[model samples]
Target: MKCHRCGREIPEGDNYMHLGETLCEDCYLDIRMAVKACDPWAVHSATRFREGSGHKGTEGLTDLQKEIYELVKGKGKVRKEEVIENLNLSEQEMQRQLATLRHCELIKGRKEGDKVYLILYR
Candidate 1:
């Protein structure tokens, strides 16, 4: 690949820039830093740096577990049976997902009045 700005051949694994047009790795970083430093407060006020992990860690969850996660997230708190009905999953599958999420520390809660309310972990 060629850097559109410098017309230099871009090496493998080299940073590719997308500043109106593609640029070399070094030039791209320089431009990015310049823009960021131009207004330090604008960049620093976010309180934290967020980056995409690309569902890498999420791959550990099974299909049922992912469904349960989404269900709990949407509903706030749900009983074990509600999940089964909403997801059309077997009791065994629901229990499996619940166990996986609990083991992974992704959720926390207990039972009350024969109903199990699952609280999602942030």
Candidate 2:
């Protein structure tokens, strides 16, 4: 077969490659190593947020808020900043969501050493 990119004759049993593109083992290794050397945080930042949801259009969280609720479970209390950092939410957004959670009796918040901690009531 011939390499699509370089048009070089690809040897037999070299690599199956991706259909039309006859990517050799060396090329494949280079691509894989390049990917491995890139920052994991950059890769994570690209795909952490799932797309295609009604919640994407709305300010109110759908499952992400519930995810935070579940995370705080078992732990008696957690700091507001910790929740904000872990959940990737802003302080104002977390405060609003916490208020809703409190209204629903799922969590309660109080001042602890000048920092607010939310206690999972459920």
RMSD of 2: 17.7
Residues 46-94, model 1: lDDT tens digits: 2123224334223445576677887787888877778889889876456
Candidate 1 clashing pairs, residues 3+ apart or interchain: none
C-alpha lDDT of candidate 1 relative to the true structure: 0.63
Kindly provide the TM-score of model 1 when superposed on the true structure, using C-alpha atoms. Answer: 0.48
Write down the lDDT of every candidate, Cα atoms only.
0.63, 0.60
Candidate 2 ranges with C-alpha deviation above 4 Å: 1-61
Compared with the true structure, what per-residue lDDT tens digits does model 2 show for residues 13-55?
A: 8865654566766555544543443334433433344243323
